[model samples]
Target: MKKVFQLILIIFSILNSAQQSEIFKLKNYRISVLNDSIQETSGLNFFSEKLYTFNDSGNPAELYEIDKKTGKILKILKVKAENKDWEALTNDGENFYIGDFGNNAGIRQDLKIFKIPFKNNQLQNDSLKIISFYYPEQQDFTPKNISTDFDLESMIYLNGKLHIFTKEWASKSTTHYTLDPDNFEKQAAQKIETFKTGFMISDAYYFEKKLFVVGYTKKTEVFLMIFNESNSGIFFKNNPWKLYLGSALSIGQIEGIAVDETGIYISGEKFYSPIGNTKPYFYFIPKEKLKF
Candidate 1:
């Protein structure tokens, strides 16, 4: 009986070690600290050969164009809208979509996305479109507050529709939902699929037929997922390359991800954890360095 118990202990330790070994330490090159005005940077997007970002709740409703090399604020474009938890940014070549659906409490009924038109590399204020949507599966409006699966933060524009990924704090998974961009009325989001990602998906980006998601766990464990597209909206059909990219203790609270032809860009807000305090900063991972 003693020998059998020892053998079981050895097996358990080996499995734990294997899982720990999967955690990869990323060589994060800190470009610079974000501007003082845009401290709570929530989402990032590359458009018109420039990087654009915005602050989350409690900040002014403005879009900031950042210098890619220095992380400095080059331009600030004010949008005529409310910043009720702006979480994700994506552009459809001509129009930029701002997701105002960062429902950490899971009880918000006013989930919306703002569509602003841009022409000649400038933002036009006359054609502001508001898209209201709701999840068809959410039956309860009760506030779960960081413990609900209805909270969403990541989004991408694909095939003339907007794809949203939920930040499920309770279930540690993400649900994919599609919304038509042409529809302005309150619409029902079509649930497509769910991926069990064990991390709260904070931002999403689609590049070269691949979908990338960046997020972190409550314990500060950070992760990045890359999915090869099998269809337009079908992302979970193939298993994603789940890379455990160190911990938020060293990387801060990762909230945004953007991929360009060169490599991946990541940003994190100021985070306070039991391990240590982390300042808001931007990081770049070169293309050649992000090997599976």
Candidate 2:
């Protein structure tokens, strides 16, 4: 009986090591400190060869274009809409969409996304569209700060629709939902798929038929997940290859991800916890390094 127990313990240790080995460290990463104006930067998007980012709640309704190399604010565009918890940014080649649905507590009913048109690399303040939506599954209007699954922070514009991924703190899983971009009516988002991520999904990026999600666990462990797209605008149906990139202590509460032909870019806001404080920083991972 003692020999059998010893053998089982050895097998368990090996399996645990194998799982830990799958987690790659972000050793070859660059950290660029953002300007003080964008200390609470929440979203990132690459449009027309420019990198765009914005602050979350309590900040101005504006967009900032930062120098990717130095993290310096190059220009600021004053948005005509309110910035009530703008958490995600994405573009459909012509217009930019800003997600104002930063529901940390599942009590907000005014979840909205601002659609702004741009011409000559400048925002046309005359034409602004507001897209309001709600989840039909959520019935409770009570506020539960960190115990609700209705909070959202990730979104993408795909196939003429806005795809939203919920930041479910209750189940640690993300639900995929789609909303009409053109319709101004208060539409109910159609839940398409749900994946057990085991971590909150803060932001999402779709590139080369692959979907990449960036998030962190409560323990401050940051992770990146890559899923292969099986069909047009459908990636949750496939299993994702999850990799523990690093810790939020070093990565600073990652909230945004944007990919281009060069590589992947991530941004983190200033994070404070009982453990310590992480400064607001932007990190770049080259395409070659992610080949592993």
Candidate 3:
């Protein structure tokens, strides 16, 4: 019996090591309703101190810009076709890249991200770039059965490359992968690392040497994982993912996160169906308040 107990303890230790994540708590900020009509928001981004989001409720996905710290909608931009299925959003310091690749069932044969260039809030023609790619290892569109497996929900740009993180709803764990920007082919991403998040990872952002990933469980929450590395780059592998904040029980779905030298920003997507529509949210945690 003693030998058996020791073996079980060893096994549990190894499993725990593989599943550890950040130590900080997640915090969610509330939003005031701007419109009861703009519903089922799917994608979001931060540009020029403003929050930009898109909806996938019906034909012609619409774009809305709002104040960075307030949920107030400032402007509603042009629409771009129907069923774009906007999933994730990122920027390259100059233009915004909107990813329309939401393969929840894994059956999608074609996936793409649109790069829309913006100058002083005005759209530019022929400046639109679409990036297309797919998963190399996946042969079928079956839901993942494992704890740490999930589909794509969010991503960010690090060192000129697009790093995508998956949100495995069934497993509550997150996986990390990277896409090369210079490689126009937009090949299947290479696996970088995995954080046994133990929570749904909705979006990620890299700022001031720290990485912030947000999601929730019993309630809407955010996980702030900080990376400590040398100038060589790959050294980030050694950084520990710790819990950042735990917000109010009322905080809804946190779908997007973006960071700058000033502070960190997050956006909440409205839940649809019988419950009706909830207002979109733009909340921020200052740079000084974010613990490294």
Per-model TM against the reference: 0.91, 0.91, 0.74
What tens digits encode model 1's per-residue C-alpha lDDT throughout 1-292? Answer: 7756754564465345338535556535778777778778998999877999999999999999988888789988999999989999998999999999999889899999999998876788789999999998899989899999999999999999999999999999999999999899999999999999878999999998999999977766778899999987789999888887766666778899999888888888888754357788888887888752
Off by over 4 Å in 1: 1-21
Candidate 2 lDDT, 15-132, residue by residue in tens:
4533753676663585687789999989899999899999999999999998878778999999998888999999999999999999988999999999999888799778989999
**Clashing pairs for predicted structure model 1, backbone only:** none
Candidate 3 residue-wise lDDT, 242-268, digit = tens? 654543223346676677776766666
* lDDT scores in order: 0.87, 0.86, 0.60
Candidate 3 deviation (Cα RMSD): 7.8
Error of 2 at 212 (Å): 0.8
Q: Judge candidate 1 against the unseen true structure and give its global Cα lDDT, from 0 to 1.
A: 0.87
At residue 136, candidate 2 shows an lDDT of 99
Off by over 4 Å in 3: 1-31, 37-39, 56-59, 79-83, 143-150, 182-186, 218-236, 239-241, 244-249, 272-280
